[model samples]
Target: MSNPGEIAAVIRAVLEALPVDALRAANTAAGESAERIAAATEGTGHDAPREALAHIAEGIERTGEALAGLGEIRERLNAYLAVLVPGVEAMVARPIAGPAGKRPITPPNRRHHLNSVGRKSQVREENTVILPGTDVRGDLDAIRRGEAAWLPDRDRCLVNGRLYGVEVPGTVYPDEGPGLVKLNRSEYKALKGLIEARGDMDSLPSALANNPAVTGADWQRAAEVYEHHKDYRSEDT
Candidate 1:
């Protein structure tokens, strides 16, 4: 047992030598920092959920941009079609007229098909000629005399193995077909009866109108018949 004054002095010296005050101040600062950290964490919440929301907003904006681009492209295509439609309609509105019963002339690219059919055989073998009607008897006699004339009114004629050409009743080229054949006596009589009934020699001929002569007739004899007939012969002849 020491004196009370001396004991108190020793205890004070021990407390000063130790770091107790420094430790207390450090603990108080640590508690304040922890509380600040807790408040900051509560205020902001989880970073992951906010990041997910930001990504969703960005994706929606990109999708909207893509849809707008598509709409612009569609508008451009519609404008192109609107300009093109009227020109196409105008072309369709106008059409070219061709011959009534004849084939459209062969195009250049497909003309090779005609080579096998039109063999360029003898004119007699390729009897593709169609002679003038009886109204033009003088023209027929001139052809028999070895003259080549372009007779527009009739199918072209083959005279002395030569083609006398025409346009309306087109001249058949050597490769086209065999020429006309002779009409039998009975066929000739029937043809004459048709012509007599119509009495319009310049109009469609008996063969073309409605007669057996249409298939194949002796156009040479047919011409002669029209020439001799007083009712059918031209006034000039």
Candidate 2:
């Protein structure tokens, strides 16, 4: 005899046990593609194409929402199944042991290094040329000074904390021209002093403005480190 409740439980268990990393990644890509197309077409005479792309982005968003909804449904089913069956979660989560008596053919690091396919697949430098315009250095300097951020926004990196013209030439885009990349030294003294004094992020604005070399990117990276090591401060208080 077959049971609908039992069938639902199996499905729920499978949903809970499976990873959604790839699905979430694909959805994020689709959304970004839509954003790029929209940004590229803004103020141009391409309303129809832009509208279509916007629709496609909406569809991708809906699909992601549906996947999240499915996860919620799985939770409900698991609750129902828990009442129907005992130790079901444990049974579903049981680990499968690797094959016994199988000795290593190569050391892990050596095997990874010797992966010929991986080596060939690595991205090789195609070309490099200087990206002119005093703006680029200015932006990086601002970022170093905590006055600018280079965080991701769709297909573009927000330049100098500018709210508009996000897709213009010389702005940070993944593709197209920007020519050669020059590494700029980050000034971390001001932010470093604040950290040494055990100051939180609340009072960083004035300190950052004073230090032109210590940029916004430096502040962001510092914030992440502080978050991870915050317990050290907590222990003192």
Candidate 3:
């Protein structure tokens, strides 16, 4: 019912508002963006060079094992004792035992463990001193080499109640057990008084060292042992 001029004008207005290929162009651009993102993610993947990483890990493990072996060797070396018998060559290396006794035992690692055990046994032995039987000579020897203390209490002598002073073998404490030798209440009190009086613990006499007798080198060893056993009193004391 409208005139041709009016109808043409409405058609042109509708066509002008619609853009050609705009939706298709938008979809193409979106697809390209998605593809680019996928490519970037694949390129950044950490899956390459796994063999190199594995090799690095293997090297680290080998290094750790080697270090552990060196540590064992060091421990053995520190605890090794010189050959006491004259003309005997010092052990160049710890001896190793072989299976079925058929193979020659010369493995250093085995010797190292044996030496470690022997060192511990020696220390344990040094901690105990038999009284009365230990004799004056023994007492002097213990003072020089062992962790020895004397409880000369008249009433508490291991043998006769003669109450004569005798140095007995006793553990240094904390590190060493009370063992066969012990300090009586009176002895403990005396020792406490002496140590407390001194400003420097090293000034205390060598007899007071964990041992009654000690070699010259034993002085340093005695100081280290007593420093840990500073709380001298037994529970009852």
Where model 3 places Cα greater than 4 Å from the true spot, the runs are 1-43, 46-48, 81-237
Identify the leading candidate in terms of TM-score: 2
Q: For model 3, how does the per-residue alpha-carbon lDDT over 1-237 read when each residue is reduced to its tens digit?
A: 356445444444443433222322332233333334445656465654444434433443343334335434434433332212224233332211112012321212221121122212223222322222223333222222211221222211111111112223321121111222333333332233244433244655444545534344443443332333433343365
What is candidate 1's local distance difference test score?
Answer: 0.35
Would you list the clashing residue pairs of candidate 2? 129-180, 143-215, 143-216, 144-214, 144-215, 145-214, 145-215, 146-215, 146-216
lDDT of 2 by residue, 1-237 (tens): 268666756766576655444444455456456556767888898669767875765665455455455455556766766766655663232121111012211111211111111212222232111222324445333222222212235332222222111322223322222322222223233324445445555555565546676678756644443333332265456
Instruction: Give the distance in Å from residue 86's predicted Cα in candidate 2 to where it truly belongs.
Output: 2.6
Superposed on all Cα atoms, the candidates' RMSDs to the truth, in angstroms, are: 46.2, 17.6, 37.4
Query: Better model by lDDT, 1 or 2?
Result: 2
How many clashes show up in model 3? 11
Worst 10 residues of 1 by lDDT: 89-98
| Residue 101, candidate 2: C-alpha displacement in angstroms | 37
Q: Please identify model 1 stretches exceeding 4 Å from their true place.
A: 1-44, 87-237
